[model samples]
Target chain A: MRSMYKSSLIACIVLISVLASYSFAMAAKKVELVVWDLQGYSDQQWYKNANKAFMEKHPNIKLEFEPHEGVPARPKFISAVRTGNAPDVGILNLYWVKDFAMNGWIQPLDPLIEPETRADFFDGFLDYASYDGKLYGLFTETGVATVLYRKDLFAEAGINPPKLLEAWDFEEFAEAAKKLTKDVDGDGKIDIWGIGISGSRTGGGGPTTFTQFPFFWALGGELIDEDGWPAFNSEAGLASLQLYHDLVYKHGVSPRESYSYTWDDIARGFSAGQYAMALLHNTHAPNMDKQFPGQVGAMLYPVPEHGITSATTAGGWIYSILTDDPAKQQAAWEYVSWMLSPEVMKSMCADIGGLPTRRSVFDDTMFASDWNQVFGRQLEGAHMKPGDPIFPLIQDEFAVAIQEVMMNQKDPATALDDAERNVVQRAKATDILK
Target chain B: MERKSGSLKQGWPYILMILPTFLLLGLVTFYPALYNIWLSFRNESLRTTVSSFVGLANYRRVLSDPFFWGALGRTVIYMIASLVLRVVLGLALALVLNIPQRGRSVARTAILLPWVLSEIIVTAMWLWILDHRTGLLNGLLATVKLGPYGWLVYPGMAMGTIVMVSLWKNLAFSFLLLFAALQQIPLDLYDSGKIDGCSSGGLIRYITLPLIRPTVTIVTIMVSISAFGQFSLVYSLTGGGPLRSTELVGLYMYQQAFNFLDIGYGAAIAMVIFLINIALSLVYYYALRSESLY
Candidate 1:
């Protein structure tokens, strides 16, 4: 009887110890979170530092940051979401939020964002983020398009630094381009082109589309209806395209080669003195400043008429929490909120040479000064592309139509008609017709 | 042993032997192919949560797409242009390298370097070479005072450059095959040709060319099929650009499926590509049969 009792006590003690250790092991395991970003290899160091800072605060969370190679990120992001393999957080072009949200691949961020937190972001940015009356993302970095010029080129051409809001419409812009365009070496070919606006995928052909498209928008031309149906065919739209044609074909102000230029191509060409003026963005301004030192100047995109109210396109990257886990969601928001805080936001923008999307950050003396001053003023007129599910497809069709017209594959009227029809059909198919 | 019954002893081992490969094929290929076919007949969109059968609509849409046609034509052009050049150039190089000469092994190894380099690196290098404003080609042309010609900016030139780059990256396989074929020609046969008053050209024509024709045909068909599916080099280099001039059906289908989130349309395009490859293969088989080369 004594031996039996003793053995039973030993077995019970051993079972209890085993269960306790197993429970402890389970409790101690760190929560693993994945984030997909397009920050690229060059920016990997910054991410590492930021991630390290994040990890130190939250010891139980392990964050994995994966950077995509290039433009393929869009497709990769879409595929991951569809296959239910999307990361806990996704950083992408702000334009993608609508498409992702529309597809129901992403959760509405309203549950994560509070009204007080929402108020901290710039109103224009918030407006851009909200689609169909729901908040889906947090905007990061300001992407305002500006006119970057070589001060040396301006001085050499005997042209004064451009004054504010002065309408340098089509003709004036062309004249400046002609005066600045010089072969210099008598090589019988253009050694220095006038202006660099990509007709290529570098900017998604955006320079031509963005810098030129705004003129049409300023003139009251619209590409799609409020319902995301086709609407670009108009007399005003042709007039907009004609301006581009005249610039490349007739005036020879813009480089015909811009059609093949990429984003880096435009900036590098400018750095190499291949072009006098580049309708570039603040995103690229820091590099321009570094490359040319004091030779860089900035202004709003040239207005249609010198005095016309210039409307800049609101663009930027967005960060969104991609998780169903409440703890991970809270942790991701912590990172976002920390990043968006005025102190952090100002420092990042100053370091990266972009605009801060937070309105509160504008009060910072560093942000209130020269370079940031330019960015702040530009942000006012900046507008966002419509946050419609069909927007990306619409943008692609718009680009194709513009290229076709510019390359003389189709007349403007016919090109617009075809684009309009394709877009409507696509929208209908996607059930966005209503 | 009495005749083996239909028993576990007889059947179990056969099942075990074939099971692994069968499972792997099912896992890797068969399932995905069936899924894609199923996706083709469904209405898939980023907006909708539900997938519904849309039947032939996706196929009709793909057939009517101008971008699809443009991309298909470009793919065919790239396929034919690259394959023909690869075959001719590869054969010529193989013949030259096959000569009894010093450092022939080194020559063969050196020629294969471009083919061995990673595709991304090759693409980055070519992009530097063809950059419009500050590329090496433009700079060299400037030295001759010939032109600041926009090599990559020009639509036609851009497509040609992409094809050329692709050919450079893949031509080594053709060269190796042809070289092997040349080496396989019996030494005794060449000696006989030499004895029969065969000069260098005559020897190649009568003995070398006819004998290697089989290898040449095989390489042509293989290269053509590979080039028809060409996507990466073009995607990396031109991105089917300067006005979508270099767009291939592969890139288009990719964009449709992934970027546009139109899986049904994308799958339709893939099926079209499949049909095209099948048709090309059939035509090639017919050509081979008519010549009775096999």
Candidate 2:
């Protein structure tokens, strides 16, 4: 009996040792991955849900989410990188990835991503986050600048409706815009404008450039030439500026009051039925669908010719890893890869009704609406802003000319020439024309 | 506790009390101003990793830029315009409120509402009202055959609208101070002026304005400093735009610092603005040295 009791006690001792070691191993496996993003208010729930689902799947990794806005957020991240305390992973605008990569603040994800994973995302977006053949990020939320128009208004005016299958030429588009403009109140003032173009230089130069760059592209103008010099003084640029001016002054489709509007104001005005057509991003699809229901129409930007080369600017957030710790790098890759996967992306894009960066994610049918399908197809033709590290500063300098021309303060040629000169001087000062 | 020995020892507790206050002020205000001054003499930009001592090159660059001088000119104009409007409107409101009229408490409370809210909030409220289309002001204008004017778009009108909004936000403080000053002035002065065959306007010129001279100087200095540093309102409202018609020096410094990413040049602009504010304050201080309120 005493021998039996001794064996049982020995077994209890063995069980306690094994249990303690297992608990220690589990404790050592705890990995805390910090992520910063600019998801906005509407998309916060997706991040929260992703965090819970990711943690449950891994059961050893804790995801810490810090959401921020765009303008103020970029500088904060830059400052963190300067201080050597940036988050393990974060989302930044694709334009900023160039500058961050130039400064060597963010690490290249090329070495981290596998071949199959790399094949999952579109090459058009992958090129945006690449600097000198090193892929630095994978775009998560993508947007394509496109024309949002009124289907009901087109019907009421008996216009050949714009379609994703065939975009309207500039001449036809201008004529249609003139017909849609109306003074329904008989007050001698136009109540409904034909187009919503943001003419304000408010909130920096971004709003003016994002909405107007497509028109410049269609007019055969380039913001910067192949040699990385300001080429906005070309005849095509003058024509594009003239087009913007004529919309306000000659065509009378846009109002003089629009000079006070920002991009936000333009969006609000479009929603308030102030404009029959507006240039907006694919990110605006869900809101447009909800507000105007089946009455809203989507189309690629009208080109100078109906079927010739068309262009739309693509911009949005890309997930970048900022840490040098290999363990943390692996953990961050897991989070980023999971976030960019087809299943997770389909869930997020469906929840927010946002444009997906990966082609495989769109096959889920949640984004199979006509509007979504159109914007999704346009992603193949969309490209990043010309490869310049100082593109934001360039955009700012160029906006003065756009504002001057649109406000009728200066003619297009003089304004474009002056803007190009200013850009040249600034580029020389910064010493980074490329 | 026992009695302290030397004068310095006796003042130890008082010094300890004020020490934290000084440290807080140094951390919050003086340190940043000095650091900015130090930065103004260096070459600091995002493109360069190491900042080198440039010795007034940043200042030279900013001073030579035409945008800087234009912004400075507008800032001076903005300060003077805002100062004039605030004093005049504040004095008028103070005089009216000090008359002991009906609903006087309600009026006093309502007068302080604009000043109590933050400048950004007030600017947003004003932006909605002053928007060119579908604004309260424009809607009211439409009732008549009047304008749905671009009040915040036209150059001169944008600056004027900013000044008006600044006045609306800051007038209450001046009004309260002037009102307090008015109360301290015995009613006997006004009665005596009346007894001596003085007109109401005459009484105000000699008795009221003279008595409020010191308070007006304080009000001018306070309002001028606040207006000189106005950043958020213009940053949010007009973005100093319509071709920078309303670009204050503060907004110029921000665009230089962050947008242009040249911290040295931005610091130079700030130091210049700071020096100008000090000179203006000194001038006002000497100009309004009151000669006995009696």
Candidate 3:
């Protein structure tokens, strides 16, 4: 009987040992999170450092990284959401938020975001995150269009670049472009163009409408009415397009080649000393600064003398959780909330050379010595594109018209009229008409 | 009929062996085509997962729009232009390579190089070569102190450049087919023409052209069909630009469906294009009806 009791005790001890080991293994298993984005790649130190710190702090978790760019990225994001195979969190463009929210592919973040944390960001940025009366994301950076120039080139040509306080109007901007446009090599052809703007998929009121829409808006042109119907084919719209045409065919200051340049090409060309000025954004300023130190300058977009429009594109990248599992969502929220902290936001915004979305980040030491002084002033009136479902369609139509005018295929009046007609016609076939 | 049924019953295992392939093909090609046809008749938007049938509305919308017709015209023009350039230049290159000369084998192999190049690589290369501010073409022009022409900025220039790029990309296909046809023209036929005191030109007209008819017809039709459905070249080249100067139907349909989120309308456009391709195939088959070329 004693021998049998000893055998039973051994068996029980083995079972208890196995159970304890299993418990330890389960506790040590690593949690995995994923992050996907495109912007952080070109300059990755910000993301790399943040990711490194996060991983160090949470040694029991793994974060997978994926990145894609161009127009095709949107469809990939949507497909990920639909399949519920999305990253724990992702950097999303504001344009896709409406479609994503409407399809039930993403959850509103009203529960994750507190009123105090929400108030930290500017109203315009928070407004970009909110759709249908609920917050779906947290804005991470400031995106607004601005005029970037070469101070050295401006000085050589005896033309002063525009300032944030005394911004140049339409005529003054044109005069500056002409003065700066030069045949530096004494060749008959122009060696350096005065100003460059995107006329293709990169910019020019189509795919990246913000780059060109503000040009029209600065002249008092509105793309859509409050009813979300076409409203751009007015006198103001025609005048804006006419100004573009004059710059191309008449003025000869803007490069005809701008029509072929993509968004990346515009900045690269400017860095190559091919243009005197570029209509780009603060998002691009840092990269430009890297390529040509002390060569980049910034100002508000050129306005017309009378109306003096202050409208700028307040578009910014937002961080949001995509997991459907409640536990995973909470975990993802932890990573997101940490990234949204003022320190991380400032570091990232500084690295990207864009304006900060958070009000507190403006007080960071880095912002004091940078171009934020001008970019911040411009942000006061910056606004996101309309949150309408058909905005993409509207932008495409507007882009086609802009391309037509720039290429001299149609006059401003003809192009805008045709575009307005096309948008209205297409809108009637869908829910956007209402 | 009884024998046929018996054969079918005996071939059941063969059918089973090929079933996976058939299933794959059906899923990838046939299913998508049918689903596209169904989408053409529905109202789909990003706002809803469920779509409702709206028969012929999308078709009506496409037909009534002038831009659709305008784009269709451009597609037809681009297709024909690509076809002619490919045939003429390809035939020339093939004839030159067919000559009995030194390094002919090397030249023939060299002709196939462009055909194997990735489309994106070719597009990027051309973009660099033709950039307005820093293009090789402009640099060469500056040698003569001539114009720095905007190769892709102007509408007409953009259209011509896309055609040229397409010709460059597809030239090898035409050359290879035509070279193969040239080799099979029986030497005796040419000998007979020579015996009749025929000139080189006469020999080509009498013997070469007649014997190569079937092959030439096949080559023409095949290249035309491929060009008719061209997308990647235009997409990467000018993005149908300087303002829709190069916007082929494929890019238009893509923009409508994917970019603009008008999937149903895009699907309708796809169906229309499919029918157009079918019609084109029928026309070519009739036009080129002949005995086997190979």
Candidate 4:
């Protein structure tokens, strides 16, 4: 019995040493970086290819991916941040960057971007990522709004495409819409609509806001002054709203159903030949191309009458690092730098249907051939929203104004007046008027 | 003194038996409630780990905010509409089901089907059925030469649609309770009422209502509580859209806490909601208690 006990103790000692050595060996292997995002659409195994190549170069490192839907992702990410369990890297909208940066949730990335590499990115792209004179995130892609139309339906109506459709004023746009609204099959009810502009709750609020900006900008209506005081109550602003109100109520070219359409609905409605035109984001076009072949074409938003140039809103997703761990931060910086490489960006734009934020990527022959040129065209005239803590509140107020006017809850003049007053009051209370 | 000491010794075993339940209750319920109350005083944000105490500022902001009042008012309206409809409809159906008829069991099962289905699935089904263009409701209306109407988009109709969904999903519990109450109504009372020349309406108005008043009151309270805290149906259906017409307190709280990452403000709103619900329930209980006494 003594001998048996001695043998068992020796075996136990051996097991412990072996387990310790195994754990040490495993720990010595390269660290894995986690990138969490919600953009889940994968085209023809492109991300898989990118991952394979990336892994081959960094054989010791691994990429961990977590995809989530929009509604649940917010809560999950907030919980993760609250518990100090955020991923090493994340993809978030540009509007979210300021909020995250102001709260110090994300790290400043200026130190990560070497001087030599800074020249590779577009200036506008770089500017969008910087806040308070510090870079906190890098834009993976840029998106701009455009009007997508069905070529077949346009041809069927015997209506020639408007000359410089991308630069047409409001009156020109309305005229084209009216010409396109005919019942081709002689059905008393209208089967095809002239335009599909979303005023609905489910619709992409960004695009709705984007689609409205040109009118305001063209009329020289400013949301804020040089010192950032509320300035949207100007005459130009009211005129812009008057046009939006007229688009739905007076001209009657846009569909009545548009009040409930989201980005997906508008895209799907256009693809299904229900509407002739849609105020759409460039990112949605590639997917629509796949879903409905050779049916759609895109143009930059129309210029406003008496405006110097056409304007559209430019927005996109950015990669933000959420950790302060030196090792993880180093790994994340490497991943981010690699992801922003011109070749990698081209692949991402092609694979994920996002626009490349770098101007150099526009030279790729693939963009011209792959129908991504629309993003290039739209980005040339895109505008960035003023980054502020009050931006989301402003967005909400703007959306409310749109609903009020579109739903006929109030007249255009009254709605704009109310919005201007409310925004001013909110700004005063929040000390944002400065 | 000897007997009292013996009783104290016996009480120790009972305490030991109740200890686990008390521990579980404290761990799960009491701890979070206390923690949340503490959190409401701090400027906790999703962006940072460090938080500072802001005292009643969160409550001040929440109370003064227009959206809060809008959501609260909408929630009250929704609660009243859904509670009334659920109780009335559930009682009517239970009364019908209590009659001696063929396939009564099958009918009861069919009526409870919506309650058994997942809330998300039920919301999705209603979403399709309420779609302005391709919805079954609109389609049927069109076939009958009635004009198609927007069921979910129109602001006046949005709350009605939500109330309908809440009623459909929650009425089954009330029905079951009322069915049991009906079965316990003592058949001889109805026979005596008939001999006294009481009409069916008079019998139900007097005998049935008075007898089942307590069960009905309980059902009303339960339905009111459920409706007051509605989250899933509104979230899935409208997302508080078309200009925040359908925004409920639960959704507003969620947006404030999760989307805006303002936990302190969110918590303040939550506490306010909790207080209001307690007050409302107490008032309801008192009114019922008085009615029962009379």
Winner by TM-score: 2
Task: Give per-model TM-scores.
Answer: 0.88, 0.93, 0.89, 0.87
Each model's lDDT comes to 0.75, 0.81, 0.78, 0.76
Per-candidate interface DockQ score: 0.42, 0.56, 0.47, 0.37
Worst 10 residues of 1 chain B by lDDT: B285-294
- Candidate 4 vs. true structure, TM-score: 0.87
lDDT of 3 at A81: 66
Ranking by DockQ: 2, 3, 1, 4
RMSD of 1: 5.2
DockQ of candidate 3, scored on C-alphas against the true complex (2 decimals): 0.47
Q: Encode model 2's per-residue lDDT on A257-361: one tens digit a residue.
A: 666567777777778888889888777756876789888888877778866666677777788998888888888898889888887787777776677777678
Measured by DockQ, the strongest candidate is 2
lDDT of 1 by residue, B43-102 (tens): 875445577999998888888777788898888888889988999999999999999999
User: What's the lDDT for candidate 2?
Assistant: 0.81
> What number of clashing residue pairs does each candidate have, in the order they appear?
8, 0, 0, 2
What is the TM-score of candidate 2? 0.93
> Given the true complex, what DockQ would model 2 score?
0.56
Q: What is the C-alpha lDDT profile of model 3 across A1-434, one tens digit per residue?
A: 99999999999999999999998986688778887766544357877787778789877767787876734677677666655677778888777776677666777888877788888888877777777898888877767887788888999998877655447878888899999899998857687888887778532244346777776777677767887777888887888778878888888998776656677677878888888898787778877877778878887777778357555676767787777777667667778877888878888776667677787888777787536777787777676776567677678777787777777878888888888887887777766785
Compute the lDDT of residue A114 as modeled in candidate 2: 94
lDDT of model 2 at position A312: 74
Candidate 3's C-alpha runs over 4 A off are: A1-36, A39-43, A59-66, A80-88, A163-165, A185-187, A201-204, A249-252, A256-261, A290-292, A306-309, B1-19, B196-198, B291-294
Tens digits of per-residue lDDT for model 1, A1-434: 99999999999999999999998986677878787766552274545566677789778777787877544477777667768888988776777777677666566678778788788787777767767788778876766767788888889889875575343666677788889888889956787777777656533444456655665676667766765566667876777776666667888877765556666788888888787888777778778878889888776565667556666676667888778788778777777776566666666676677677777777777766555666677666676676566766667767766777666677777877877787777667556675
Model 2: share of true interface contacts reproduced: 0.50
Report the C-alpha displacement of residue B42, candidate 4, in angstroms.
Answer: 4.2
In candidate 3, which residue pairs get closer than 3 Å at backbone N, Cα or C atoms, i.e. clash?
none
What's the lDDT of the predicted structure labeled candidate 3? 0.78
